[model samples]
Target: MTRSSIRTSLLALCAAAVCTVASAKLPAPSPEAAAKAAEAAAKAAWAGKVDNYKLCLSQDKVAAHYRKTTPSANPAAAGGAACADPGPFAYTPPAAKPAEAAGAHSPPGTASSPPSTQVPAAAAAPASKS
Candidate 1:
């Protein structure tokens, strides 16, 4: 093949690959489809916290956690949107939730306070018959 022909073929391959990748990504959904998807995502995200989501304008606590952790770049309030934070390590001892609160248990001797509603009782046996 001539040099020009080879260059053209390589360019065409690159263009085709780009188009294929772009098409695989999400496209502009129709209004109805977009609304349906938004509704589904909202339902799934807020699953059991519809009331809190409505009241706070966000259903996910992950965003709140991020807001608290990151510092804001803009002078204005983030309006519930998350800003960047230096990190928990910036604090003297790092004010993080206790291991039990995060559902993590330490070794037997190193165990901290137990979580609320944690029952340490052993399984009860059936009552003896007369």
Candidate 2:
């Protein structure tokens, strides 16, 4: 093969290898890891909100300054929506239900009954004729 063809083949092979590695399934996160991930995600979301709030406040201040300095033919509207302040970062982890409360093993009211109440198949059958 020509040098260009060889390079193209190698590049295609490398691309395929990268795609295979990227598509490979990742192992499920442990419960603790999952909880930490959830908390991190919550924190990131709150941080984004805080950033947006700060941006809004800064924009309002700039607008007010501009209005004071510049004379306009027509005054801007008197009222607009106020900038919301995201007070604090607080994340409350969801409560975990106890195993008993989860009711995974059996439905409600069945726990009082015995383990097995049905008679054996052979015993329940009538005796065969001679």
Candidate 3:
């Protein structure tokens, strides 16, 4: 390469480096500049799709599912329980017994087990040594 070309290349590289450093040290863009940049970006983003931007965005999101990382399982997180091999409803209704079967059915005129007498015999008993 000629001396002039070599010097030109070095000058170009130096200018680029100076601009990069200066830009890094510069204050953040003003609100107006930021808004302008955002407007420009948005225009560029949906350049052709002024009407069908929503459809385009939805399609892009669907395509991006393949590129997205699978979320890692968190031990502490609660997850919905779904039956992989669902059979019949797992919940069985409580076995229905007639009130008469459990014990003598209280007459309609009387109240059922009074609150004071509601304690079971085992619970009413004092704690026993094993």
Candidate 4:
């Protein structure tokens, strides 16, 4: 190689070594920074999922509408109007009894009292037997 080329190569090697040493001396990312990065990644992923869901639901609605307006329209051509599931996390219970419903609406730290009833003494049973 020419003298100039050799000189340039050596300079390049020295620059790379300097950069490596400088980077190695740098501190690692803080916990807060790492958490923010993770959160950003999650949000991006969630946004993508939401976009897909919206597109799917819209397609179904269009298909259903077309099928409704034109009964004779081809089934393959008309996408069904069924919406994508929101999720299985929601729930509904059977109608609560009056007593149970009332308790559910009460504030916490306020426990209801048990039913009051009278009971005979233990000796009462033996007295009755005799």
Which one is best on TM-score? 2
Which residue segments of model 3 deviate by more than 4 Å? 1-24, 48-130
Q: For each candidate, what is the lDDT? A: 0.59, 0.86, 0.61, 0.69
**Candidate 3: clashing pairs of residues:** none
TM-scores, all candidates, are 0.21, 0.69, 0.23, 0.37
How high is the lDDT of residue 30 in model 2?
96
Q: Local error of candidate 2 at 20, Å?
A: 1.5
- Give a tens-digit lDDT track for model 2, residues 1-130: 9999999999999999999999999999998999999999999999998999999888878877777777882345536788788879899999988887899766777467688769887787868989
Q: What local lDDT does model 3 show for residue 101?
A: 75
Candidate 4: what lDDT? 0.69
Per-residue error (Å), model 3, residue 50:
7.0
What is the descending TM-score order? 2, 4, 3, 1
Best candidate per lDDT, number? 2
lDDT of 3 at 66: 41
lDDT of 1 by residue, 9-100 (tens): 99999999999988896768996786678667655545545444454544335455666777773424446543232222221222457779
Instruction: Give candidate 4 regions above 4 Å deviation.
Output: 1-28, 75-130
lDDT of 2: 0.86
Q: Per-candidate RMSD vs. true structure?
A: 23.8, 7.7, 29.1, 20.0
Report lDDT (Cα) of residue 65, candidate 1.
66
Indicate the worst ten consecutive residues by lDDT in candidate 2: 70-79
